[model samples]
Target: MKSSMHNPHLAPEKYGIMDGISECIVTTISSKGPNAAPMGIIKNSNGIKIRVFKGSKTYGNIMNFPFLAANVVYDPKIYTMTTFSNLERSQFDTIVYEDVEFPVLKDGISWMLFECNNLQKSSQSLVADLIPVKAKLSHIDAVRAPNRGFNSVLEACIHATRYQLTGSQKYLDLMQYHAEIIRKCGGKTEKEALDQLYRFMKTNK
Candidate 1:
C-alpha cells in the first residue's frame, strides 16, 4: 500500500521530517531562557542520530542538557527563516520533558522524547546516537500532502547553502525545480519564497 503522499525520493519531504530524513529543532533553556535551533536527525541500523555544528548554541545545549525532546514538524518556512536569518518566530510550543523545556510545533501531529544516550563531537559538527525513551503522536489536522510553502523555502535555502559547492549547476537546478512547483501549486502560494530566492541569487552573485 502507498503511504500517504509517499515521496519518490529517499530524502524525506523538502522541509519537514520524513522517513530517512534526519531533522530536529534543538530547544534548550540556559540561565536566561529558551533557545531553539534546527538540527539534522538520522536513523540507521543501530539507532537514531542527530548532527550539530561545532561551537553553536545547539551544540552547547545538547552537551550541557544531555537529554533532548525531538519533534517532527511541518514548517519549512520557519527552518529557512532560522537558517538564513538566525531568528526564531513566536509561533511554537514549549513543553517540559524530563528536566528541560522542549520546543515543539503546536501544529505538529506527533512528538518524540529521546534521552541523549551517546554524544559525539568533532571539528565540524556534533553527532548524537539517541536512545528513544518515549515516543508518540499528538493527533492534529496534518494530512499527506506536501506543504508548498515549506517546499519552496527549502528549495531556496538548500540552493543558497550549496551554491559554492555545486556552482551554476545548483542554481539552475534549484530555480528550475522551484519554477516547476510554482507552476503546479501556483505562484500565489509561494510569492514570498520566490522573492527571497530571487533576491539572494541576484545580490549574493
Candidate 2:
C-alpha cells in the first residue's frame, strides 16, 4: 500500500518524528539526472534543516534545484553506495510530485519531498531550511531494527567519506574503530556493510 500527503507543513509523527540528526538518503534531480547522497536531517518547529557542504554534487544540485526528496531507509549498502560512488538509475524508482522529479529507493520505507525556503551560508557549507511539500509511505515495518551496531556503521561511513575528501588519518582511525564494533556487535547485514566500506577505503587509498 502507498500513502502520501500533498502539503504536510510539519512532519507527521507516523514518519517517525525526528528530533535531532536523523540520517536519510536524499535524492535530487539535476540537468544531469538523479543524484543521491546521505544527509543528516533535523526536524524543527519551522521545518527541516540539512547542511550541504561546498564543492559537492549534492550541494550544487540543491542550489540549482530547490526541490529534493529525503528517503527514510535502513539498508547499509544504499548508504555506502551513495556516499562513496554514484548509484545506477536502476537502483531507484522514479516518482513525480508537483511536476518535480525525484528518485526514491525501491526499499525505502518512507520519503519526504521538500522545497528550499531559506539558506544560510557559511565558509564550508550551506544550511538549508526546507518545507515539506510532499510525503509518501510505501512500507512500514512492525518492528524497528535494534541499534546494536547499525549507528556505528553509519557513523563509520561518514568518517570514511571525510577521510576520502580530506585525506585525514583521523577519520580513517575512527572508521577502523567503528568497524571493530560492527564486527563484534552487528548482525550479518552490518558486517557486510562494514566489509564494503573497508574495501572501498583500501582500494581508493
Candidate 3:
C-alpha cells in the first residue's frame, strides 16, 4: 500500500478523493464504443477500488479492456442521464494513451485514468483494484455552498439504477422518498433531473 501523496504518477487527493467513498462517473471503451455510468470508488493507501455488477456495459467493457477513466462531476443531470440513458457522442471527449482511446466527460471537473489490476470476480460482481496511471483537472473549483437537493438527486439516481437493474419495488420507493427532498430543496437543475428520471422510469416500466 502506497500513500497517494508519495505517488508521482497519480494522486487521489488532487481529484477530491479522500479516505472514504468518492462518487464519480466511470467511462470505458469497448469494440462497440464508449460506456458511462455513475460509480462510487474507495481510495485508501492500497489504492482505488471499484465494484460493478455483471451484465452491465461497464462490467463487460472493463472485462475486455481493463482501462477506464473516472470523472469527478458535480452535476446531477449528468448522473441521471448516465444512470438511465446512453450519453451521446457529443457529450464525450477523447484522450489516447498508448493507442487506446479513452472517453472522458466534457463536463467533468477532473478525471483520473486507471488501469484495472488485481481483478476479482464473483457470481454477482466484479471487483477491481484501480491503479491510477494518469489524471487531469479540467476546471477550477468554484466556490459554492453544499446543496442537499443536489446531493439527494444523486442518491435518487443511485436508487434508480438499482431499480432498473433488479426491478425491485423497494428501490423505486426510495427514489420517491428522495423526490420529496428534491422538490423542497433542489434548484432548477435538480428538479429537472428528477423529472427526467421519473420519465425514464415510466417509459422503462
Candidate 4:
C-alpha cells in the first residue's frame, strides 16, 4: 500500500533513524491506559519493522488500534522503568490524532508516529511493517559522548526483561556480566538505573 504520510524521508532523517536497528521506547494504548515498552525498530532497505510477541501488551494494543509512537530517548532510567514496570502518567505527553491519544515520553529527543501497514503473525509474534504518518524533532541540540556504562545498563536491562518473560537462567547470567561493566564504567545514572532494574526484578519475583 502507498504511504499516507507526507515527507516521510525527511522525518526519519530528522529522527536519526537509518538502515539499522534503532532501539526505542514505543508507546501504545492499552485497556488500562497508555503503555510503553522498549522495542527495536528495524529500518532496512525493505522498510521499518517491529516484532511484538503475541503475549505482550504492545502486541495486543497494536492489534486493537494498529498505531504506535516510537520515542527516541537516551535516558537509561526511563528505559529501565519502562522495561520493568509502568511509567508514571507524568512522564508522558499526549498527542492526539483521529481522536486517539498517543503517549510520547516527556524526555524523548525525537518520535515517529506510525500506522501498522501489513502485519504478518505467527504463533510467537507479529511482525508488522510500519508506515510513518507523523513525527517530531523535539531536541536538536541534545548530544552526549558514548558511554560504555550507559550502554551496559541497556544491555543488562534487556536481559532482565527477557529473564522475566522466559525465566531463563541464561538471561540472568548475561545481566550479571553486564553489571560488572556498569560498575567499572557507568556514572551515577547508569548505576542507579541498574539498581532500580534489580530491585524491580526481585520484588516482582
Which pairs clash (backbone N, Cα, C closer than 3 Å) in model 4? none
Q: How do the residues 84-144 of candidate 1 rate in per-residue lDDT, one tens digit apiece? A: 4444435557766444465555655565655665577788987876655444467654665
Q: Model 4: per-residue lDDT, tens digit, 1-205?
A: 1346644465576786667988899999877888999998999887888999887889999998888889998888988998878799988899977666788888899988888878899999999988888788989999889899888988998898789889999999999999999989999989999899999999989
Q: Name the runs in model 1 displaced over 4 angstroms.
A: 1-19, 86-89, 134-136, 147-152, 163-183, 186-190, 194-205
Worst-scoring 10-residue span by lDDT in model 3: 1-10
Among the numbered candidates, top TM-score falls to: 4
What residue runs in model 4 are displaced by over 4 Å at the alpha carbon?
1-9
- lDDT per residue for candidate 3 within 127-157, as digits (tens), equals 9988787788877664458888998998898
Could you tell me how far off, in angstroms, the CA of residue 83 lies in candidate 4 after the best superposition? Answer: 1.0
Better structure of 1 and 3 per lDDT: 3
Q: Score each candidate by Cα lDDT.
A: 0.58, 0.79, 0.85, 0.86
Model 1: pairs clashing at backbone N, Cα or C within 3 Å:
22-41, 23-41
Could you tell me the lDDT of residue 20 within candidate 3?
A: 80
Measured against the true structure, the TM-scores of the candidates, in listed sequence, are 0.67, 0.89, 0.91, 0.92
Score candidate 1 by lDDT: 0.58
- Reference-based lDDT, residue 49, model 3: 95
Write down the worst ten-residue block by lDDT for model 1.
1-10
